[model samples]
Target: MSTTPDRRILIAEAALDLIAREGLRALTHRAVDRDLDLPAGSSSYYFRSRGALLDAAVRRLAQNSRDAFTRSGLEAPERTDDVDASARAVATTLDEMLLRRRRDLLVRYALAVDPTIDPELHALLATGLFSRDAATTLMAAHRSTQPATAAADFVGLVEGLVADRLIGARSRDGIRAGTADSVEQLARSIAVFLRGLPTESTGTRPI
Candidate 1:
């Protein structure tokens, strides 16, 4: 199938949508073509096998994750002096991800639980493009001597909270109020967690 760069991205995004809404079983080349209203063999032309298509979709979602972080102004903070400000930035970023980019997060979470996607997911996370790496970088920016350890702890905390919310652990209110409350709670938790960290190798000055 003759394809352009744009069409490949579109097909990958369609795969993500299918997985997010209909489940991974529904992520077929034909299903993607049908969803996109493309020619019969279009998706197959670009991705000959199911694994190939899934890989493409996973990569696309990774790129989307990076884009979202950048858009939320959490890509990289210039200073680590103000932990509260940093925490708020992180909370705002999570609010954006949970509210505006929920579908992408769902796709990521779905892939996380799928053993078939484990290799691909591991590769993606290792690339410094997703959460673990992002969190590591964030900690390093704050001059944590053991950035990896801190990042792991912080990411685990946040991911657990998010997964709990996503899996119907709590009832959600209307979007605005829910998002605000979630962000506030995240910010507070993040600040508190950071404060609990050892201060020896951290650049985070005491407030």
Candidate 2:
């Protein structure tokens, strides 16, 4: 191939789509080339190795997630006092991801469970938009007494909610209910969780 950032990104994206549609076992340089309709060996020329291809895919996934967060305005400075708005913003972002970018999420889940994946790649997959650092920033902005712990819990809750809609028992129900219902329910759940956290103003123990 072409020596361009766009070309590399295109290849990586094709790899991710292949993984999402056919599972990790179907990911290969030849498969990616076939998916993109590129000549044989094109993917290999750029990626060089399976490990390098996986790394590129992981990086692409992270970039896509960050772009989604930025587009949703969630990456903006925290509002501090607007818990409801923040909750809704997060819910909206999640809803968009589920509806418009489900393939990315599916690929993420596939990589997350593969034992052969590199530790660094696994960590990159885990560090999503609602990562511990981002959650901690939100918690701190809200004046939570224990920002670190609260952030951990918040991230866990968000992950659980996403998983529920993706693979858990509620997956079918969430799908049938559609985007509007999912956003409303997710916003409500996030708002409740945020409000329940013990903040400096509340002077209550961490929950």
Candidate 3:
């Protein structure tokens, strides 16, 4: 019942872990309290309602993602100019998510498809691990004719790649694919995608 920041974060993280391990239906205030081994009504005291708890979990997910990105050096401006470096940076980040932070990604995907989730929260999870704005900047640095469109395509491709590794038929192989293999494979794909983009000199075509 105490209003400590750490307790709120603990509740939210417990909720995310519950969703990842047991699915969204298992995520109740009492369930979160049980997961955290907190006193009865502890989670509810902080979150007040199911929706609030879900919001806190989503926010925690986003915060964790942003922290990971920052740690991956994706925010470095110098890397954008070099497509291969950018690709590797992104690939490394993806590898981290797919392996170390798999639970967070699973929780994100689970929440994404649930209609009961808030529209704003839905928007928050829509971007997946990387934002379109970051992709747009990368595309612009690569001299894409239409950076926004290129960014959309890039984000979509990355999303599919991650999803395939996480839940698609490739899931088994992806799990066996270690960090070196995963990062190399993803970096290659990203490099090829960046290279295939229509550049400014190629000129834009009618949409």
Name the best candidate (by TM-score).
2
Candidate 2 local lDDT, 25-113, one digit each (tens): 89899999999999999989889998899899999999998887778765545547677877887888778877888898889999999
The regions of model 2 sitting more than 4 angstroms off are 1-3, 174-178, 205-207
Off by over 4 Å in 1: 1-3, 125-130, 141-145, 171-178, 201-207
* RMSD of each candidate relative to the true structure: 3.1, 2.5, 3.3
Instruction: Identify the superior model by lDDT, candidate 1 or candidate 2.
Output: 2
Candidate 3 residue lDDT tens string, 1-207: 655998888888899999999999998998888878888998898899998999999999999988887787766454234677778878888887887888998999998999888899998898647788888877877778888999899989999888988899778773443468888977888888876876686564212
Worst 10 residues of 2 by lDDT: 172-181
Model 3 clash tally, residue pairs: 0
Give model 3's TM-score versus the native structure.
0.90
- lDDT of every model, 2 decimals: 0.76, 0.83, 0.83
RMSD (CA, angstroms), candidate 2: 2.5
| lDDT leader | 2
Ranking by lDDT: 2, 3, 1
